[model samples]
Target chain A: MCGIVGLLVKKPELREQLGALMVPMLVEMAARGPESAGMAVFTAALPEGQRKYSLHAPVWDYDWGGFEGEFIKRFGPEAQLGVQGNHAILTCDEPADAVKPWVRGHFPMLHILAAGRVMDIYKDTGHPASVAERYRFGSFSGTHLVGHTRMATESAVTPDRAHPFTAGEDFCLVHNGTISNPYMIRRKLEHRGIVFETDNDTEAACRYLEWRMREGDNLETALGKGFEELDGFYTFLIGTQNKLALVRDAFACKPAVVAETDDYVAIASEFRSLAHLPGVDQAKLFEPMPEEIYSWTV
Target chain B: MDGVNATDRRRVFDLSTARVRDLNQFLHHELPGSGVEQVEVQHPGGRHAIAVGINHPVNVEVKGHGGYYLAGMNKLASVTVHGNVGWGVAENMMSGTVRVKGFASESAGATGHGGTLIIEGDASLRCGISMKGIDIVVGGDIGNYSAFMAQAGHLLVCGDAGHALGDSLYEAVIYVRGRIKSLGADAQEEEMTDADRAKVAELLARAGFGYQPSEFKRVASAKKLYHWNADANQEY
Candidate 1:
């Protein structure tokens, strides 16, 4: 059991309050998933010709004094790095494919959470309220965001096991149920030279989508392929740079509610997570049918 | 406002200050007689177990939406929600009536023993799962796996039903006016008799639904799954 929440602000003015509006929704989900909480925010695009990469370490006491000099020496002088809590965001003119491998070789302790133009991922193993406060999430400004509170049904209670798992480039996914055939699917993807970070089933699902998209499938087509291959009771909220999509398994065993209004489109595991959204009282509320993909974009 | 009479004084409970426990405590404090016969609950959204375990005959009107197990183990109390409801709206209810003016989530009346549950809008998955002896009426559609493992009761769906209706059903009777996508293990559609039509008509009228009894179909257990045999194991 887990809680997933996604918000796509239709009005640009509400972007700054995205995190503020999301706090109550995340906190309400504490009952569903008390083990860990995570979020992915899609803010304004990166500066021209620059790419942003989010990195996560176990502790905030990691050395950062020589980080800028090291990055400059490896890549170029156009690199900029900043540390907030246990997360670090690095912006550079180099491509992600070039910087990612070099960063991994230099910083063995750091795990790349997300590397994209508009996405920044933050997560930790703690209560949702405390984690949100620690990261000062209320001040975050973004066009859209996706969050997850994990109950840790199968994986260890580690920060890396937390959700909003990044798929490819700017895509991320948060899942609620388990996949029964993940090992078989993982082997199949591995045979296709697709690398995996964690043994989490959700990661396999995300990577499967990434592989499909890499083979020239759009988000909708990739998801349609997933419906045919994936087996289990699952409700997924996937986030791209411009779109947020929701899909439930054919059984629809997992719960999901969608509320749409003039200002925003919100999706959550239950209505309580969406009860406080603006204009929610007048919003159109309905349960997403099984195997149907519901998506909204900027 | 509508059900209140001259003898019964209505008391308003603001959930902002008084929690759901307080509301239940106020109702259960007096066993046989809680002079307050009518309760008006305000700001009821995001709260669970609003008026559970009520023994006395009272009327509760929730002004807004409700959370899980809104009226579990209720007895002799008529609970009404003006807005939508979360999962298990009247789970294991013993008696009285629970009505929702809006939609209801999964497991609306799960394992209810005896009572009347009415949902004016659609009900999500598992509307009457494992029901023992209750009467549930849904004015709109219901999702998959409804009436699963039901032992005894009556479920009346006015609209379409999703996949796997009455899976592993035992003794419970189901009347669906719209399409049934599928039936679960050991459950089969039976010919509706005159008595079944009368029962369906009465339940629909009681729930304030206008539908012809002739349009409905009855579903019951085939009694083929009560015993196990090695030859029947192939069917498994």
Candidate 2:
């Protein structure tokens, strides 16, 4: 089993407390998932033509200053990197298409967790609370975020296999159930020249949906296709540029509860995580129906 | 059953300071002769297995949202949760009444044997799966595949039901006041008689719902898939 937690602040002021409010929710679900924890936070977008590339190194004290100096030497003083624990957000005026290939060509050891104008990803294999502390999750400020705690049923327990798997820019998915036909989906995507990052089941699903979106289907239509093609028990909580969407499989094979108030909307695998939220007693609490997509925008 | 100095008839359990295990230990081990007829639990914080496995007659009120298995294996105890609950609330309950003032997650009263489980708000999927002799009343719509393979019981939903209301039923009966998306295999709707109406009325009254009995429809097993048939080739 795994735990999926998402929060989208309706009030702009609550965005500052997004990570603080979500850490408790994530920690409460450690009972459901204790193997690994990860999240994708959607911060304020950089100006047009700029992007943030989230990079993770194997060591906690990697020399980010040296890496930034090298990047500036190649691309001038336009690239700036902010280091946080083992994770760093490298902001550059270059688009993703330009920066990704260059980073991959130069630094083979650094894992690019995500690249987008607004989203920053941090994930590691550890207890959710400790991982949160390792990444300073309490001080994160964002309009919305999607987090996951994995029990690692189908894949190995590694930081790269941890959830909030991303596809295109600003899109990530965290899953709470296993997919039955991931190999089939993987074959379909790989046959189309789409590369997969890992053998994890959630990666297949994330790549599938994003492939559909790249091919012209919007999020809802791609999710409609996901309901048709993806065969298995899944309660997928997805994060986009400005939205948080949740969808359960047709069988309701996994559990998900949603609590929405005027201030924010919180989605978790169980209500146990949501009980600590502010104004939750008065919030409108309900479960999303099977196969229906519940989306909330920032 | 050691030295507790509670002289009041109503004892309160503050979950903020007291662990759920200790609170349950008090309800399980020392409450019979403790002279505390009512126990109120505060700050439940959505914890699991609160006030479970009670064998004596008592009143337990949970002040806020409870987690999974709020009152499982209950007997002769009336437990009320004033807020929402997580999965499997009052599962495998044998007797007495367990009520939730707010909504419940999946499998609300699964495999219950006796007593009444009432939800004033909606219940999620599989509300009363494999029930035996228990009664369930949902004030709002129930989710998909409710009452699946129920052996013997009465499930009353005052609101709409999602897909496959009763799948692979046995002797249990289902009375739905609102729309049923579909019925499961071998489960068919039958004409509601006066006795069925009276049964609905009694349960509704016991659960304090104001719905009229005439608004319901009955669903029971058709017994088609009861035995092995060699000629059918496994098509229902």
Candidate 3:
């Protein structure tokens, strides 16, 4: 089992409190998933001609400053770098496809968590509260955020196996239940030239969406198609650049509650995660129907 | 002066500080006829088993949602959830009432032997599977495979029912006001006789649902599988 939480701020005034509002929710999810935690925050859009890439290393002191100099030497001096906890964010004028290969060839130890204009992914293997504190999540300001506390069902406990697994450039997915046929799906996806990092079922599902989207299917279409193709019990919270989508299996064995208000829309594995949100009591609350796709945009 | 004292001052437990175990412990420890008649539970969403295994006739009012097994093995207590509930809200409940003002997740009243479980909103899959003698009244629709293998009980749905309304049912009576997508093994629709209507009316009134008894369609076992026949072996 795992716990998934997402917040989409419809009111601009509440955007600054996204992380602050999400911490308590994530902490409450500790009972469901205590192995590791991960989060992805979509901040304000980047400036024109710039893109951001979030990378992580195993240790806190991983020579991020030196890596920045090396990146500038290779990708030109127009790159800006900032390090938070074990993650390093690089904003550059170069496209991700061009920069990724160069970084991969040069720094094989670095793992790219997300590459997009608005999304920055932070994750680690620890208690949810400790991971949130390490990244200082309470001070973050963003239009939307999605987080996960993993119980390590099918994957290792390494930070790389933590969730909010990235799909395409700006897409990420967090899952609550195990997929029974991940290996079968993985083989099919591999035949279509989709590379996989871990043998985790969530990664397979995430890659399936990315593959479907790449083949001209929209997010909703991809999710609808996923419901037919993916077998097993699962509740997924998917994050795109500007949209957050939720989907559950037909049986809906996993728990999910959604609350929508004038200011924000939130979803969690249980209501406790949503109890502390502003205007929670007055917010409209309901469980998502089985096999239905519910999406929200900022 | 009234006999109410400080110990019976309507105990209030906040889930933020005291866990669900604390509340369940309080309810279990309270003996019959204890002065603690009313208990209010605040911040109820994240916890599980909030008032399980109770024997006293107290009232528990939870302020918000609840996790799995909210009132499992309940007896005599009247527990009310102002919000939704997770899986098996009142599993194996012997006697008492478990009410949810909002929705309930899968198996809302699984294997409950007796008591009343009321859901003001919809209930997910298998709402009353294996129920022995409990009475479940849902104000909204219920998901698929409800009342599967139920030996005895009464299930009342005010709204539509998903596919396979009652599979492998025995003795249990089902009443639905809205559409039943399909019926499961050994389950078939039956006539709502005068006695059945009276029973339905009594249950609806007990749950505060004002629907007329004539609107409901009754479902009961077909009684075909009780004694197996050699000719039916091929079908099996």
Candidate 4:
């Protein structure tokens, strides 16, 4: 089990304050998932350039220098490189539609996690506090953010196994349960040449959403498809730079609570995580209905 | 309150002083509305009524792993637990129901004045101890001394019962099938008549257990202990 949280704030000023507020909530849920923690922030873009999708993955065993040279040759000079441990972040200025096909065609061992302008994903092994420290996120600033604290159970415990996983550049997801049908769905996505990073089931969930989006389905529709296709227990929150969505499995085995207001929306694995939110009311305690899919756009 | 009381998170509360001070404080403490939703207690380490006396039409879900007297004295709330509950779950409950999806510790549904208590799994010793006007239906086997001293209402067990069932019972009818190791003082096995079979069948259906009433036997106190006769040196 893991702790997942997401908030869509109406005030842009709250963007920077989001990280500070999230730190306490994530820390309190340390018992739920103790392996790793990461947060993705989405802020409004000032430049309004073409949509960009970026995937950061740690390449292992292979020659790092040779891989970097080959990656630069494949994507050319537009690619920006940053290294963290064995991980590397490759980004480009091209539109997501133009960049995704090229990345899939070149990297046979990579999985795309998020596809959108202003997309950010951070993950590392250890507690949420340590992971946040690794990113030097003294204060996270974003209009909307999704955070995940992962406990490795069904999947191997590694930095790559962390949540807020992205598929292509426009879609990103964080999950709190197991996906029983991951291998089957992975095979299908592999047929489409979507590379995978970790052996985690969430990789299939990411690819599943990408598969639906590529087929011209909207985010909500793809989430609905996930309920029908993905098996096992899951209460997940998926976010892009422009959209936020919630999905519970048909059985609703895992727990997820939502507190909504006209000004903002917040969701978490437990109501206690939302207890410290400014306007929480005990009267609105409700669990998401089983098989229910909720979404919002900004 | 942000969540359950910080002090109560690790402290143990017993049946007499059982209180759920901040039951829904985590879920709806900041929202506006009266809509019913489910709240779960991840680890109920000997805490009572994580949801007791809730005034709203809510569904309180305790994900098992709980302690004594869960859902005790509940009113206007429906509680469903996913695991085994401790002694006296739904005790003194009024105007609402308590459903146990798994086994019960002991004395479940004790002295409940109203509402139905359904135990889908087996019940421990002293099951439904001193039940008064509550309708208790157990799907699986019940341990020894079930329905002992029950004053009123029905105690029905769908599976076999252990020793000394319905010891010194009065008013309440004890229905069980299969073997009984022994009977409590003033309690005895009776004939399984049609009326007894029908009553047991109805309770089984309501408790979501399908059973053949003919496979059960009726047990009740002989009422010899209800009054004192000064005639001989014998006391029933």
Candidate 5:
């Protein structure tokens, strides 16, 4: 079993300072999932004249600093890559679809996890500090972030098999627990021409959410739809650039503790993992209700 | 039982010799490592995981209290813990004897594939859930939901039973001797005939309890929930 920690601050003040404050809580939760760790921050960035889209590329345990050079080499110098906590934030000069094929062709393992006004997803193998150091994560700014510490069971320890797996633009997911029906779900998704990048239950979970999102559903509704169809134990904390959502399976087999005060809303697999958060009173802890979907945004 | 130490000639240790925690750990590591046949742990402090995962055919005598999961999954060894055990004592055990001289916690022998778990005291709720061929004999009152979904076994509770006893039991014979609060879904009270009385008497004797066989009540499943009907539109 792995651990997942996610925080969605309703106010901008807490959201801007999330990365610095959440580092210790993520650090304490290393034991629940010791194999790998990752975090993503989704902060809305203002643009002029047109829709400002940020390409949320989940760099699968690749060279973070060299991603800019690698992207330029693959898609020519016109494509620019910015850094955001191990993920390469791409702002293309044109619409991202023309370069999506080239990007996929260049980095076969690279997954276009999310894309929107402020889509950000960063995930990798190893300790959070190691993944943080390779990408200079501490300085990357964002408002809301969802994190993961993975203890791999079904898939290999590659970056593609990591959490926060995405499907198309504006769809990102962080998950815990196993999916018992991946093979059946995979075949259905493949028939629909949805390309799956990894052989992970997490990917299936992402595809389930994405398939629901494609059906004109929002994040909370999509996750609620997932709960109805997906079998097995799971507690998912999913986020787009703006909306944050949480969903647990019917049985509540996997553990998830949620706490909310006047200041912030925090959640992890255990109360011990939330020790570093400000004003985490033990009495405030709560287990996520089974088959319930919770979401909040500013 | 000095005869156990003299003729059995197992490793003997008093409270002054070593702590029960160290003694059990030593016996678990060294008995299997050194091929020692039998061992004893005296004056336990309700600590957990004593004699866990012991594969060899050794006889372990644990004296005093214990916490959770005592003698869990003992493959060939016989562990006689001479005190009350905490929750999930002997949980998921396979092929061994766990005899508790005192009370056992909730879900005692839960999901154990195969074992003979004899408890001299009461057991808590959900005891023997999904039990597969594990024979449980409790000498005292059993809490609610006993023998829940027991696949195959004989659960002999010699005292009063709590509410929701034997809920959703499957292919398991439950013989309770005292008053029952309520029977759970899919489970029904059956007639305690001469044959069931004999079986209960034999099980009580095995657990070192001397009780009249006719004083017990037999509970079993009605087998209604075994098959599913897709088209019948039955709510239950």
Candidate 6:
């Protein structure tokens, strides 16, 4: 079992308190999933010529200064790295296709969690509260965020196996239920020269939706095809640069409750996760219907 | 606030300060002759299993939304939630009445043996799933797959019923006032007889509704999927 929490603040001023509000929501779900926790936050878009890549070092004390110096020397002075323990955001003026390969060759041990102008990903295998503290998730500021706490039902427990799986750019997805046909979707995507990161079923779903969007389908169209091709029970919460979408399986076996106020839209596996939110007493709360896509724009 | 207070006969519990376990313990602590007969839970904050497993004839009034299993296995207690409720409220209730002033999530009265659960607002999927003798009355629509495999009970939906209503039914009777999206396997809609109208009127009166009984249509088991069809291809 896994717990999923998503929050999208409607007012721009509340963006600064996004993590502060979401920290409690994520922590409350620790009982649902205590093995690992992760979150993907969407900030304001960077300058048009800039792109940021979330890099996770192999060790907590990895020499980010040396890595930053080497990157500046190779990619020119336009490269800047913002360090945060083992994770850092490398912002460069170069394109992703050009910079990604160079980073992989020079720093092969570093894992790239995400790449986009607006999104930053953080995940680790630990208790939700500890993981949030390790990454200082409470200080994060963004327009919206999607978080997950995983229990590792089918996959092995590792940092790389954590959720909020990113596919292409700012797109990320978290799942609660298992997919019965991950290899089938993988094989289908592999035929089209799509590479996979892990054997995790959520990754297959994540990459498939990214592939669909890359092939000129909008998020809605891709999800419609997903409902037909993807065979499993899933309550998927997806994150993008501008929107956060949620959908449940046909049976509605898994639980999901949504609370929307004039200022924000919050979703969780249960109501307690959102009970402490500000103005929640007056918020309109409802359960998402089966097989229905509910998306909120930033 | 005046009637329910810090007294032997009436009590108040603020879940923000007090523990839910404590409240439940009080309900079961020699409840037969205990003078504690009324409870008011304030600031529930969506806690689970509040006021559950009661055997006394007490009155519980929850002021806010409730989480899962608000009052399960209740006997002779009349529980009322002024706000919404989460999943499986009043599940397996033995006797007495449970009422919700707001909406309810999935599996409201699942597997309840005996009781009357009234929802003033809509109820999500599987409202009365596998109900033995409990009667559920919803003031608004019910989601899909409601009353699946219900053995014996009366489910009254004042609003529409979603897809596959009463799939794989046994002996439960469903009364829908609004449209039924679809009926489940071996579950067919029948003409409402005078007895059915009287039942609806009785339940509606119990729920304090003003809707006319003639508006409801009866749905019951067709008994087709009951016996084994050895020669049939089970294509369904």
* Over 4 Å off, model 1: B1-8, B30-32
Candidate 5 structure, TM-score to reference: 0.58
Model 6 pairs in collision:
none
Residue range A1-298, candidate 3, lDDT tens digits:
8999999999888888999999999999988899899999999889878899999987898899889989888889998888896798999998888988888899988998998899999999999999999999888899899999999878799898899999768899999999888998899999987788877888989999989999999999999999988999899999998999999998888888999999999999988788888798899988888899999988
Off by over 4 Å in 4: A46-92, A95-115, A136-138, A282-284, B1-236
Cα miss at A171, model 1 (Å)? 0.8
lDDT of 4 by residue, A1-298 (tens): 7989887776666676777767766765666788898777785552566454435545533344565676667667656655444444555556666666666787655545555666667777888877777665447677677888998877778766788787765467888888898999999888988778778988789878977998999888888888788888898888876877888876455656666765467777765566566655422334465577788776
Count of steric clashes across candidates, in order: 0, 0, 0, 23, 3, 0
Write one digit per residue (lDDT tens) for candidate 1, span A1-298. Answer: 9999998889889999999999889988988898899999999998777889888886777776566688899887888887887888888898878987887898877898998899999998999989888887788889999999999876898888899898668889999999988888899999988778888989888889878988999899999999999989799999999999999998887888888999999999988788777788898888898899888988
Candidate 6 vs. true structure, TM-score: 0.97
Native RMSD of candidate 1 (Å): 2.4
Superior by DockQ: candidate 3 or candidate 6: 6
What lDDT does the true structure give each of the candidates?
A: 0.89, 0.92, 0.90, 0.71, 0.73, 0.92
Instruction: Report the Cα lDDT for residue A111, model 6.
Output: 85
Q: Is the docking of candidate 1 incorrect, acceptable, medium or high quality?
A: medium
Q: Give the TM-score of candidate 2.
A: 0.97
A25 Cα displacement, candidate 1 (Å) = 0.9
| Candidates 1 onward: DockQ, in order | 0.56, 0.73, 0.67, 0.04, 0.04, 0.79
Location of the lowest summed lDDT over 10 successive residues in candidate 4 chain B: B9-18
Cα lDDT of model 6 by residue, B163-229, tens digit: 9999999998999999999998889999999999999999999999999999999999999888998
Best by DockQ: 6
Residue ranges of candidate 2 with Cα displaced over 4 Å: B1-7
Residues B1-236 of candidate 2: C-alpha lDDT, one tens digit per residue:
24545556688998878999999999899989877889999999888999999999999999999988999999999999999888898899999999999999899899999999999999999999999989999999898899999999899999999888789999999999999999999899999999999999999999999989999999999988789989989888
Which sections of candidate 3 miss by over 4 Å?
B1-9, B224-236
lDDT of 4 by residue, B51-80 (tens): 655555556677533445777786766778
Error of 6 at A52 (Å): 0.6
